[model samples]
Target chain A: MINRTTTAALAAAVAAAALMSSGANAQTANADKERCYGISMAGKNDCAATGNNSCAGQSKADYDAKAWKYVAKGSCATMEVTLKDGKKRMGTLAPM
Target chain B: MPAQPDGNGLTDLQHRFAHAVLQAPLAVPSGIRHDVRPTRERRFGVYRNNVKASLAAALAARFPVVARLVGDEFFTAMALVFIERHPPHSPVLAEYGAAFANFLEGFDPAADLPYLPDIARLEWSHHVAFHSADASAADIGRLAELPPEALGSVRLGLHPAMAVIASPWPIVSVWATNTHDATPEAPAAGWTGETALVTRPHLDVLVQRLPPGTDRLVAKLAQGIALGAAAEAVSRAHDSFDLATALSTLFGAGAITTLSQGSSS
Candidate 1:
């Protein structure tokens, strides 16, 4: 059961937190920053499609369900994965 | 399709165009035509490719760690499949990818890395926190002034941008490692569950790993539980739980937005 002691303790904790937050705000008050919508494009190839709509032809994805070829050959390759069933496995995608 | 007088023509045309563009092999909408040329297939093909590529690129930007986890080729191919299956519902690109984590759960290629879906979920949460509406911190001085007994009924409101994610995988560590200058590495062998606190107290989004039982505490507070009762409930389950530290963490992150008195539960 909650008692007077618990209530007092929580109030004290929250009060201390307010002081710490004010300190942080003061420090960041002078920092220059701007908020903007939309993220930057990822790479040169993203814009490499040259022609008006023809650039869309430059898209690399085959989009074929049956003849898939890409493999998950990223950082997961370095790590060994432990499965839920206590079986260990390499973090590699099966080649399609 | 010929234009109908009922004004459903535009909507019908847009649906066909969207369907054609999103489809593989460039299925041009039948009625499309270019002013100077007899056929618009080449021009239409460009539209199809741009739509797929740009959307895939947007997905890459939002989920960079996911892209890094699986190399570029794999990510692009997987993203294409995802985009085709789940096209954008809103004009805003940032709102896309809410279904990506679930998609990854069923993706056959990523079956080996079972943790990928959670990582995607983590990244999406961070994205949401970054874009969430901002609000000023609530006046906490009143809490100190309230009578000690009344403190149990005080309900502290958390920031709208704050979210707590409890996961069975070491999502925070994997996300942290790939976020900065460090080269991507394997997660530690003694993999344990992790809970993350995503918040945007000010301008920048922050993702902090929370200690055990803190997630339950935050989740309770988010549900409008009063301070004293929330603490009591959390303590019953988490022997290591400290009320002061949990409150301090929330404050330090600038996550406290409002405070009010409510019937103690």
Candidate 2:
């Protein structure tokens, strides 16, 4: 018969395995995410589809406001910025 | 003595290529030539220029705020020196510039900006946060579900992208003013110490200035200390430690990722 301590350890192990699987699922879900505009730093954009440049690291200004990096869908609005006017704004889904 | 290839070994070839990238174009490794031309010095020069430009661009990309503070010309010169000394060990360019902050501290030219190194440190933290793996924020409401006696043993885990940067200068203000303002104004008077929290809760990386004792508390919690012990440590150091406000800030910013009981038992 399994001891009480061993049973407790088994339950903990199962819980940990569940947590790890959930974390892995989240990573896979975010893998195919696309770039969200207004969050990329200068020359740090993943890629621009507007034909501006063929590769990453080409943006000419800080927070170019138009360039973006691939982020999970529904997360574009979560990239918040404090504007020059001291107003907070969320990153746009498309080039701005 | 003329440099000779070590019996055409791959290791030797890689060493020579590494040297070629770090040093002058004239020393471009032998037996390595352009695809179209055979060991053309001009073609090698083109490659050298591109490599240097791209590396410099990477530095600029990683440390834009630092670049703005030092101005373009000076920043480029400094970046060249840093690139020569500490060439990237990793293929990921985003992982570059880890030594930049420390380099600035020892750089004689940047002695005037005593705060420059700290600013670089802050920027590096921001860079790291931006690329760090994502994690779901902890559910603060779960704490209430725990029995009061078991609460003391709960260990908190920080988000994968969270970091605390403690500096003697008002680094958060300095970073904020320079980043948000088109024409950055002078630093505010009554400047004192600052402790900043860098976190990427969702898609955005946020840099927030922590209150007096929060950094200590967060640091302790991050070390896997249980709730009671971490709070007691903070209380001993700072009698005014506000647990409510600090917890609110931590949860609001999504800095805490996991909460597990019996870890410290």
Candidate 2 regions with alpha-carbon error over 4 angstroms? A1-58, A61-96, B1-11, B32-42, B186-189, B263-265
Please state the CAPRI-style docking class of candidate 2. Answer: incorrect
Candidates' TM-scores?
0.72, 0.72
List candidate 1 segments past 4 Å from native. A8-96, B1-7, B34-39, B139-147, B185-190
Candidate 2 lDDT tens digits, B57-139: 78877777788889888999999889878878888887889999999999999899888999999889988998899999875
Mind sharing the TM-score for model 2?
A: 0.72
Q: After superposition, how far is residue B218 of candidate 2 from its true place, in Å?
A: 1.9
**DockQ per model, Cα:** 0.15, 0.06
| Every candidate's lDDT | 0.68, 0.72
In model 2 chain B, the worst 10-residue window by lDDT is: B140-149
lDDT digits (tens) for residues B146-216 of candidate 1: 77777788788889898887889988778766653125566664588877778888766667677678788
Q: How many Å off is the CA of B91 in candidate 2?
A: 2.0
Clash count (model 2, backbone only): 3
lDDT of 2 at B201: 85
